[model samples]
Target: MTPITSFFRNLEAKCCAACGQMIHEQAESYATECAPCQEQASFDAYKYYHQKR
Candidate 1:
């Protein structure tokens, strides 16, 4: 296997707060600022759906 593949294989997994999408450790750098969500880590589901207006 290639080093890049192996590196990705060892990465941890996480879910995006904004989109509920599976995010990998290697992608964290980019995922943290998801273009679709405007990079708002503060705009999670809880904040969007549960917070008082």
Candidate 2:
């Protein structure tokens, strides 16, 4: 693909829900949050659930 085509494609790319970081299609198939954000969300959920005990 041409550089300009790649640039425009990224302009409409999906971004991480938490940090608003761009998520490339090549990196993931259909990810909502980036890897780091997903990990943090998992950790937060675990901590919250454990704290209720």
Candidate 3:
């Protein structure tokens, strides 16, 4: 198998996989989603339906 180091580029910044937003160098190490996406991460379509029960 190829080494893990050869799999991905050592990037300073990259776009979010889900939302295509810029993740800066400081947050790239841990951030999978940007602030806007992260803030709304709990959004569920069934939430409103469940609440009515």
Candidate 4:
């Protein structure tokens, strides 16, 4: 497979785009924390959930 295709195929095992840390596909669906981005996403989710309630 082409490098690009291979990348997407195993996207689940890919590292974080910002921190270069490994990320699981299952975690990605929920909350995959990028070392660099830290908890930014979790905070965002918290906000969204609270707003929706």
Candidate number of the best lDDT: 2
After superposition, candidate 2 runs with Cα above 4 Å error: 1-11
Candidate closer to the true structure by lDDT (higher is better), 3 or 4: 3
The lDDT per prediction is 0.62, 0.80, 0.67, 0.65
Against the true structure, what is each candidate's TM-score?
Answer: 0.31, 0.63, 0.47, 0.36
Candidate rank order under lDDT: 2, 3, 4, 1
TM-score of 2: 0.63
Per-residue lDDT of model 3, residues 1-53, tens digit only: 86656544554567787799787656327778777776676565457668889
Candidate 4 lDDT by residue in tens digits, 1-53:
47976666665565676677786555436444554466776678899999998
Q: List clash counts for every candidate, in order.
A: 0, 0, 0, 0
TM-score: model 3 vs. ground truth: 0.47
Which residue window of length 10 is worst by lDDT in model 4? 27-36
| Local error of candidate 2 at residue 25 (angstroms) | 3.7
Global Cα RMSD, each model: 7.0, 5.0, 5.1, 7.0
Q: What ranges in model 4 sit over 4 Å off?
A: 1-15, 18-33
Best by TM-score: 2
lDDT of 2 by residue, 1-25 (tens): 5797676566666888889998766
